[model samples]
Target: MTENPGFLLTVLAFVLVIGPLVFVHELGHYIAGRIFGVKAETFSIGFGGTIAGWHDKRGTHWKLGWLPLGGYVRFAGDMGAASQPTAEWLALPPEERAKTFQAKPLWQRSIIVAAGAIVNFLFAILILGSFAYLEGVPRTPPVIAMVAEGSAADRAGMKEGDRILSISGRSIGDFEDIYRIVRFSPIEPMQIAIDRGGNRLSVDVTPGVLVERDRFGNEYRMGQLGIGKPPAVYDDIGLLEAPLVGAERTWGIVRLMVDTLGQVVTGRRSVKELGGPLKIAQVSGEAAMMGWESLIGFIALVSINLGFINLLPVPMLDGGHLFFYAIEAIRRKPVPVEAQEWAYRGGFALLVSLMLLVTFNDLTSFGLWQKLGGLIG
Candidate 1:
């Protein structure tokens, strides 16, 4: 496809990636609501004007809309994100509001909110594990897969299949460990210990810095060695074992995110790494071009991210709702309605502001404004 069409295709691809994750997320809420006997008025994807939908026997309106950004599951008496505690809620004759979310027990509310995120995570894990079993899990053996022509490793006479035992003085357990060291300390010259056919060799190779795009269109400067595997061996496992593997992989990514954020907080990692929808769109398009496997892998990662982010203790999010539930559980009463309203407003503002900033970053990263300026000039 032409580049212009590619952009459109990319948009569709992103929707594909995002839509299913969101559906799975909202499905969790839907399921939980049904289980708890909470009334659900609408189950909609996208927001705003409903383009198409249907009414189920249970009176739930399942619809799709023109906008494709995100979706929501509206429970009975949502009162919107910034729900008010009007006399109507209190004067609901008790029995009526009992079916509403606001009237649910603290534990039930927590479960309903927490379910969405949990489902996203579960979906990611299952996808990952299935891929692992199908593809025989690619593993790097702490060995050099290839050396870029005329690159540092080539200059140092590094050969393929040379097992990397150590970098500087630190031991290397896996090829990934070496990658982490190189990316984290790109500029530093390091000593390497290699194992070649039962022979030990030592050399020094300075990793070169290069810009790489992650699955989410975010660009990062990291050490590049210009090497990768053709296809590594995978530890075979049965169907029953795949799901656990997937869950473990999902957890690994979660741990990496936590670690990266910790590093960012400590000023060791850059905030520029933070990406938004634009980045996701760019990456989604790129992944589509790469192949189905790559796209699926990217989707899984994004799904995991969505799950983890929603679990954050920010207002208007599943985690944030759960936070209030926790307080209710502890205090034996809900936090004041005024406090919840203000908290949601603040959270919504923060979310919108962050989106704007990330979009700006995306525009800059893509040189969109620069190209436009050149056209004007």
Candidate 2:
């Protein structure tokens, strides 16, 4: 039987993308732990059986697992990848206990737990900043060059040469800002503040909903104002300023993610849009085919997502650990072990359910069920 070259490329691309990101994330935790005088017992770049491994001079057992889905850093006295405290760890003598993660001050522990996501965000910023430095930043003005007839902007009495000042009270700096605001806001009403002929005017416009498909045939629902802009102008970014640009871009992505999740929660967007590992693998492969630049950009985007997701207040995640730490701070003591265990179990279940949902969406997006039906027919 011949192997599919495309499938092979997809698998390789997925591994290449995920492995480094995972390593960066865990390295964040490991570094933070080391800084606080805590020892990492094991640093594995995947879960389950070890494919390759070694011990550092510090005695941290570093290993590469067969499964490349995710990775973890197990600190001394930590029970598992989730970093649950162990009975043996708790029972350790004062000297030994001081070297464990749980023995750290609340603030230090919080920083240590939150370090992975922070590093992910920083990694994305570095990549994005490099791109900005090399390629320059878009300096497009927010002037409307064209408005489709009888469309949302036209209906709202907007005209060509009108410079958009703000959308929903958020100031717009460039033409790209308009698209960013409109894209996730399908059919949503927004207040548009524009300066026409040097006179400021405010108009309420409901964006027209558009269903667009990508080259991969994946569908996206977007809001369009039926407005167009002139060609974008690129300005060379200085070395120092490029990082600021990258930070701004990263924050913009974070805000967009928040808006997306809000839309999903409010029933404005479908949950089916959520994707999982398979979707990532497909996209990674596609990006690889597009070139190194595209693949690198995709990695940065995913890195931001990873950082954002890990910060959510869910158990078995970094955020969940921070949540417990927050409670510990308030109560002046840790949460009861039994309560913590139950909460962890619930969090684990919630995560598993979400994983299944996203996986199902991925399969559906790939037409897996349709192909199966065809085979049966």
Candidate 3:
């Protein structure tokens, strides 16, 4: 496989992208545990059988696993990666129990559980901030340079040289803002405020549906106004302001994700739009080919996604642990072990089903079944 440069690059890119994110996630838990005087029994990158391992001076078994999907940090009382408490560890001597995760205070345990996702978000912020600080931020004015003939913008009486003031009552500061609003509102009527030659005017426009395909043959459907913007100007951002810019960008992505998920749930979007590891690998390879800046940007984007997904209130995830903690906090006691076990079991099954669905989508997107059928025929 190493001899095949393209194949090797793809594999390498996938590892490079996933490995650090997983490590950072686990590191967040490990660091939080250490801060609370909790003992980490093992810190492993990846899961299942160990490919290589060693014991650290702090009695932490550090290992690289054969499976490179995800990783975990097992505290003293944790029975598995999900951080379920073990009977033996719980029954240990008082002195030893004090150093176990389960023995920690409710607030401490909640922080420990939530640390992984928080760290992922922080990682993305740092990356994005650094990019903005170094390369400056792109600022494109919301001025229409062109309107497609007979398209939505043209039919709505939108003309070139018009400066967009707002959409749906929301202020528009940049051309990208217009794209963001219009992209999610295909065929939806919107009241757009514009300034034409210093004359304030309001126009009603319905965005047209636009379908696009990437080099990988993946399809994307979105709304378009069929309007063009002038060239963007790069504005140098201050060191302090860079992080704020990054945070805003991160929030924007989260909002988009939330909107997309809502659309999917409302049957406005197809479930086929969901992607899995295969899509990540493909995108990683493509980003790598586009140079370090693009690849690093993609990493930041993926990191935000990882953080967002982990923070979801689903069982067997970081958010799930926090959910249980929330319940424990309110009840003034932990939930029964049996109830937790059943919940975890259901969560596991749900996760597995989702994985299978996304994998099927990935395969279908790649036309794998069609190719196999052609061969069989």
Best by TM-score: 2
Report the Cα lDDT for candidate 1: 0.81
Tens digits of per-residue lDDT, candidate 2, 222-325, equal: 99999989999989989999889999889989998998899889987889999999999999988888789999999999999999999998989999988988
Off by over 4 Å in 1: 1-5, 80-85, 91-95, 138-208, 212-219, 223-231, 375-377
Error of 2 at 40 (Å): 0.4
Specify the poorest-scoring 10-residue window by lDDT in model 2. 1-10
Q: How well does candidate 2 score on lDDT at residue 166? A: 98
**Residue 361, candidate 1: alpha-carbon lDDT:** 76
- RMSD per candidate (Å) reads 5.0, 2.6, 3.1
Give Cα-based local distance difference scores for all models: 0.81, 0.90, 0.87
TM-scores, one per candidate: 0.79, 0.95, 0.90
Candidate 3: C-alpha lDDT: 0.87
Q: List the residue pairs that clash in candidate 3.
A: none
Q: After superposition, how far is residue 10 of candidate 3 from its true place, in Å?
A: 1.1
Over 4 Å off, model 3: 1-5, 80-86, 157-162, 165-171, 184-204
Q: Record all residue pairs in model 2 with backbone atoms less than 3 Å apart, i.e. clashing.
A: none
